[model samples]
Target: MRKTSLDVTAARVSPALPRRIPRLPGRFPRRLPVRQVLCLLPLALVAVVAVQHWTVLTEGFGKLGTGEWPWLLAAATTTCLAWVAAAVTRQGAVVERMPVFRLLATQFAAGAANHLLPTGLGASAVNLRFMTVCGIPLARSSAALALYILAEAISRVTLLIALLLAFPSALRLSTLLPEGAVGPLLLAVAVATVVAAAVLLLVRRLRTAAVSFLRTALGEARSVHTRPARALALWGGSLAFPALQAAGLVAVGQALGLQIPAAHMAVAYLAATVAVALVPTPGGLGSVEAALIVTLVAAGGDAAVATAVVLTYRIITVWLPLLPGALTLGVLVRLKVI
Candidate 1:
């Protein structure tokens, strides 16, 4: 009777052992959620970029000790203020009032994202997500984004034009380009515009979308500008954003003892930024550096000093904030704030 009872106990437990074993394999093979993976991707890309640019970043830091500390401190201050300017502009773009603290944090994260993705996509994506979460409709959020971008670009270009006018000798446009290059460049731009327009006209779906987007964007722009405070914040912040960026570059130039006049340095910074705006590089990383070095040299700065200045400026504005920004982005994502 004892042996029979023992046999029954073994039989009952044996079946449950196989079920538990199967669950172990299932746990080992479990996959991460797609949303989680996507959320983490930007941080991963930023890490890869940092590794790739590690040597340049180290060299940039090496020159920092020799730089004028006061100017570098000013540059750092200006960089922080630029983020505030961006947050203000973002708030002005949409009618809904975002929580000020959250808005600023989003902009900080957006800046980090901007360096990870090309052509400002990361920043745009983060802002769109944030706005959507803040209860804005998708179309209106998108339209607001477009308006913000348009305002920023227009303000930057207007500032550049005004600066060029104020200091006429700051940039010699004719000498900056090769002989006979202007006409061809203009013609090519016109032809490309025509081609793009034709393609838009030929595609019915794209044409409809474009028209809808433009109408929505115009409506949003009108609504945002109807309020005096919003209008002022929108345009004023936009104007100050680029000015601060250029000022940072100037401060860096001063720190490195670059002989370029402050006004000329500002012009060079603006021109290089505008020229490389279409390069599609992440935060205009490599391209901006090259363009800055070349433009500064053209503006009568020594090539070696210009290179060092650009590197130092980028390190202060980009590298220092990168890790913090990435961490903010991750926290925001986990919290569903963006």
Candidate 2:
């Protein structure tokens, strides 16, 4: 009886025991959590504006006409082209070999994520995941991203220098305020704030580990530096693509019946856009609209025209992208790609 009971007990417990799960043959996957460190004020700003200027938003939408459509298309096309160039530029630094289609999808998904989410977390997450999925080790992935970012900065600074040289008046902050000593002080404050923020970003090593990782993957940092000329050329091309985009915005303004100068629009658009980027808002919604309108007005545009031009531009460049971007993000989540 005892032997029989032992056998039955063993059988019952053995059948219920959990099996040993096979371990994945890799370093543990790292999750990049999306943190909304910035953009906390955008919601409140949007709400305040909604309550204060509901009439304008409504009226602005009504003014949207067929004539303005082509400019929107131009803006969208140039923006897409800029992104494509950026992705292609990044391809040289990535350690993992991925198909061009995969790279394109990753770029599209990253852009979608960046626009829809706060603080660029979505795009960053997407980028990391794409690198990981393509069999690049996490460290190398980070390094590749770093190199790509450095290239991007070189390009952006070049574009900014060109704009400043082309339109020195656009850099004048005194025009925005009453011409007192206070104007210079305010201008100094603005310049200092921008410089401080940029320094912080550029100095944050963790934010740009991708380049180091790429260096490691290549066996040495010197190996990565060997193609400096090619890298510079790629970066220059990226810069020009975005300059074309700035031109596209001017075209959009013209389409809206606003006779804005291209050089002035480029400078104002870059400044206002940079200010909006600092707001940390998803798509930089209210802050962007306000900055663009104010900048345009300061650049010799009538308030009504500025309002109309900005609204139409935002509709095409910002809101129009949100829905599709959100949908793409959802698809990425489903596919476990990001």
Candidate 3:
């Protein structure tokens, strides 16, 4: 109640003084949040897969050594470029511009996830999470994912059609698909259509959700298309992804002495990938190998050599990148970048 000049000064300075933090006497610093650690789950899973496939990786690399080094190098380069394409496509999916390095890193990490989970579920999940972490709402993020998927699929099919038109005699159905495959494929498509219709008719909640999602996704797509730069990035990246992938396969074919023309190999690759698109395997695994080999053979490649080429190509494009990609994913998760 009767404070002097000294007391007033001390009281004023006390409020501004920093509180001392307790120092733990140990080399270890702080504990990480459990939620953040959970984000690193993919890294562990990828590591496990790597361990299980160690022999395959070694053999694939050894096979690469016997091929034309220049072509192999080209294949590797194309594989790397494919990641860049994926990053670009992801950016095109959303209106907001993401950090360049983190976007690139996420795409790289998503590569590992692609192999771990069936189809593209893993990569898609990683991207959705990344978008949410970057402050994008769940619904918008989902719509962006849909837009990316649609654009990529459209671009891939369009490229295939263009290639087929440009090179009339390059790919033949008899060479690639089994005679009865068309009938079964048609039946499967019909079944899928019917099932989708039935689901929409019977499941009221699902139907409402589907309609709402479609509206949101379409709106987002339209917004994205309105921006010329975004549209360009979306379509450009989409086209480049498939093109680079085919280029990698072609390079591998040349390296392994496959007697297919470059254009033919690209056509075969695109066709095979499209055919195997519906397969539920993780990264298309056995399905991809079978399709690629059969298609390559139809393109006039020796079956034995084509097998080697496909194997080498997958190793270079998928397996080799998994570890480093996983590492990048872990780093990003740890730093809360995603």
User: Which residues of candidate 2, in runs, are more than 4 Å off?
Assistant: 1-61, 170-172, 177-225, 228-234
Task: Report lDDT per candidate.
Answer: 0.92, 0.66, 0.88
226-289 per-residue lDDT for model 3 (tens digits):
9999999999999999999999999998888888899999999999999899899887877898
State the number of backbone clashes in model 3: 0
lDDT of 1: 0.92
- Model 2 RMSD vs true structure: 8.3
Largest TM-score belongs to which candidate?
A: 1
Off by over 4 Å in 3: 1-40, 51-55
TM-score of 3: 0.87
Tens-place lDDT per residue, model 1, 36-154, is: 87668767888899999999889999988789999999999999999999999999998889999999999999999999889789899999999999999999999999989989999
Error of 2 at 113 (Å): 1.7
What is the TM-score of candidate 2? Answer: 0.68
Steric collisions counted per model:
0, 8, 0
| Cα lDDT of model 2 by residue, 1-338, tens digit | 35798798999899778788666767677554443212222334335535555665566566556446776678778777766775766565653346676677677766656655675566677887888887877777766776666666566666767887878776456655566878686899899999976775788684365445545755523444567754543565557655765776787787777766778888778767655655786656577789888888777777888788888776655545544555555565556565
Instruction: Flag the better candidate by lDDT, 1 or 2.
Output: 1
| Model 1 lDDT, residue 249, Cα | 98
TM-score of 1: 0.91
**What's the distance in Å from true for residue 109, model 2?**
2.2
Q: Best candidate per lDDT, number?
A: 1
